[model samples]
Target: MSEKDQRIQTGKFGEDAACDYLIEADYKIVERNWRCRSGEIDIIADDAGRLVFIEVRTRKTGGRFGTAAESVDRRKQQQVRDTAQVYLRSIGCSAESIRFDVIAITMSRQMDSILEYKHYEGAF
Candidate 1:
């Protein structure tokens, strides 16, 4: 596969893993790949009574760029926040508590298997 294809696969794998992880943790997944004019939310879940917006970042381990978690910088955070607002408005639901979470997955470059998975709650 081409490098781009590999990257896409890696991302999908990470998202799948993240969803499974959330389910195991008793989070009710509300949406996946939710898109709006502002941006896209990788996952939207209900964690107990609070609304959780999740960003899933995947990267190959030992990559020169940086870790997957590091990729969700200030700009990305802002975008997610804005999109969350849009989502809430569209749903006509007011959430008393909202949280931003990041699920970073690092996969082995040689094996395409996850080497690490990090979950950052209230990340931003």
Candidate 2:
């Protein structure tokens, strides 16, 4: 597989893991990979009646590049917020409680196992 393909595969694995984790934590998975002209949301779930927009970042190796959570900078956060707003407008949800979350998955390059999983609520 090409480098891009490998990256995509790793991302898919991460997302699957995140979904399982969220479900175990009592979050209802409303949607996955919701996209628009603004951007894409990795996951959209309901956490105890609060709407959560989640971003998943996966990295097999983290060193000089930084942890997966740290990769979500201000610009990316803005993109997520923009996309979330578009989603809310489309659904006509004005009074919903919302939160931004980041799920960072780190994989072991050699063993291909998860090394770390961190979920940050209201990261932005």
How high is the lDDT of residue 37 in model 2? Answer: 100
Model 1 residue 68 distance off true place after TM-score fit, in angstroms: 0.7
- List runs of model 2 lying over 4 Å from the truth: 62-64
User: How far does residue 65 in candidate 1 sit from its true spot (Å)?
Assistant: 0.9
Candidate 1 per-residue C-alpha lDDT over 37-100 given as tens digits, one digit per residue, 9 for 90 to 100: 8999999999998999999999887899899999999999999999999999999977569999
In model 1, how large is the Cα lDDT of residue 22?
99
TM-score of 1: 0.94
RMSD (Cα, Å) of model 1: 1.1
Task: Report, for every candidate in turn, its global Cα lDDT versus the true structure.
Answer: 0.93, 0.93
Candidate 2 lDDT by residue in tens digits, 22-117: 999999999999999999999999999999999999998655688999899999999999999999998999635999999999999862699999
The 10 consecutive residues of candidate 2 with the worst lDDT sum are: 58-67
Give each model's clash number: 0, 0
Per-prediction TM-score, please? 0.94, 0.95
